[model samples]
Target: MIFLSMLRLMVHDGFSLTDATPYRHLVSGLQYLSLTCPDISFTVKKLSQFMHSPSKTHCQALKRLLHYLKCTISFGPHLCRHPSHHLYAFFDADWAGDRDDRKSKTGYVVYLGGNLIS
Candidate 1:
């Protein structure tokens, strides 16, 4: 599953990633893309975890993301002017989900007029 891979990517530095790259631009660029493409937001967030020490594997992931973006250029969430009347926010927290750092994991999803806005 992609979720497992995302977690795996962060847990252990890729052994195959011997060649590190200065990839701030690529990572930041993909981060900007997350604004329009929510689908890649999680992956971009995962990639950001290693901004200080990006590896060759990270660069490859960035390249793959760029290719995916190019292929689905038209796919992006839209904010309708005539949005529904209701706006709401919901969130969840898992206390210390990561065993390594004991960092609590939190997540949220906001909706406007029953449409997922976050």
Candidate 2:
């Protein structure tokens, strides 16, 4: 699930539309999974935007995400028992990065004692 920074997904990229049922189901489940697997949160969010009418490319991306998850099933965040009192936050924004909609995208993550909290 390595998304290139320059990759831009469009609603109509000449690829045929795919069945929405399975895509919707997988995206929904991935939404829940994102709670524990923050690494895929951004990808899942991007994929969910096409739920109403997912293109073949979107379906392929979803499959690739699933494969990545399968291969990294054993990896997960570990919380320390005795965490430090330090709190850290980081964020970045892509100004008008969405080529299709020209909308800016931003994301942030918060950590407490080196453990991701948000």
Candidate 3:
């Protein structure tokens, strides 16, 4: 159940599906879940990109994601107490990670009082 990362090697060369299992809906629901489950945010973002033209491979990746979520349904974030009122944040980016558009992949997590706020 430890989906350390959802860095799938997806591409835009796959065959499109006509009756994809309502991928847009499923991914949108997952998007809502990612609000609390920060771990799945990146994967959901990746999946959401195919809403316009999803393929069979995308569906498989989504099934794996759903399976991981079901297995980790009981897990939650762990927040520890701190002595100071300082805000801590960390971010990372992969510059030009997207081969299609040369867009960067960036994400950040904001913590307040040892709690993740974003």
Candidate 4:
């Protein structure tokens, strides 16, 4: 759904789907995908490095991603209503975790009033 949403956005802006493939713009695109489809963020980011030179396997993987989106259309995040207004956050990082680049992975999520807005 995340990729599809990006595809939708570009198409809505009058760009042809094929030509709109923004593999060249993975950083921003993947960040948007993280927000729109948090469940797939990790996997999406893992695959992002190959954007500049995507292989047939990558194309097939993207197609599978689209299929997963279609199958899970009804799933979505739900923020419960509550009276508390406290803000809470959780974060984790693994330094030099990427096998290929030895770059660290940083992940975080914040909640305000029991709602995760970031």
Candidate 5:
């Protein structure tokens, strides 16, 4: 209720939350928020862990997220429309990287349509 009212106030007063979801923009927001708003970092990081099944706490964290969005509403990705189309990818892994479970850290990305699909 308070969050919705605050956001209504922000939007009515000309603020918005449209540009905060792009990958790079989100990373930057988290970084800035981590440093400038340490009070929210732990909440935000825990939210990241459950990105798949976000809880009410996660929703609250996101509502609070508007502060950062309100502050950085101007930010977004800038991509050249005429970049090369040749696809390229790099993979990395540290075998048995997890000391506790002896699990590996594997990563890969596929660029099929000018976007990282995997």
Candidate 6:
């Protein structure tokens, strides 16, 4: 689920709209998956935005995300038995990254003893 940094999904991409039921259903499941799959949290968050009116492009992105999940099904955070005392935090933000709303998007991850905690 490596989205292009320059990729910008809009509410209206000139593509035909699709049924929202499946999209909403899948996105909802992905929200739960994001709890363990931090790698997909940002992608799931982005896709969740269009659950109300998913277009063809949005559906395609969702499908790609599904495929990515299928391919990485075995990947997830693993807790260490002998956890270290060190704590680290990393974050990134895009200034006005949302093309539809011109809002900033920021994300952060916290790690304790080399294991993701947030």
Each candidate's number of clashing pairs is 0, 0, 0, 0, 0, 0
Scored by lDDT, the top model is 2
Please list the residue runs of candidate 1 whose C-alpha ends up more than 4 Å from where it truly belongs after superposition. Answer: 1-4, 15-22, 77-118
Candidate 3 local accuracy as lDDT? 0.82
- Encode model 2's per-residue lDDT on 1-118: one tens digit a residue: 3865315877774466645798899999999999888788898898898887888888888888899899999887777765487889999999999999999999998988878888
Per-residue error for 33 in candidate 3, Å, reads 0.5
TM-scores of the candidates in the order shown: 0.53, 0.62, 0.58, 0.46, 0.37, 0.62
TM for candidate 4 is 0.46
- lDDT leaderboard ranking: 2, 6, 3, 1, 4, 5
* Ranking of models by TM-score: 2, 6, 3, 1, 4, 5
CA lDDT of every candidate: 0.74, 0.83, 0.82, 0.63, 0.53, 0.82
Error of 2 at 31 (Å): 0.6
Please give, for residues 1-118, the per-residue lDDT of candidate 3 as tens digits: 3444346536563788887569888999999999888788888898888888888888888888999888889888677787767788999999999999999989999988768767
Model 4, position 111, has a per-residue lDDT of: 89
* Model 5, position 30: C-alpha lDDT score: 76
For residues 3-110, what per-residue lDDT tens digits would candidate 1 score against the true structure? 346666653566435444546767778788788777889988988888777766676777777777788787756666655678899999989989999999899989
Determine which window of 10 residues in candidate 5 has minimal summed lDDT: 6-15
Q: Clashes in model 4: which pairs?
A: none
Clashes of 2: 0
Q: With candidate 4 superimposed using the best TM-score fit, by how many Å does residue 42's alpha carbon deviate from the native?
A: 3.0
Q: Clashing residue pairs in candidate 5, if any?
A: none
Error of 4 at 51 (Å): 2.0
Between candidates 1 and 4, which one is better according to lDDT? Answer: 1
Higher-scoring candidate on lDDT, 1 or 5 = 1
Model 5 TM? 0.37
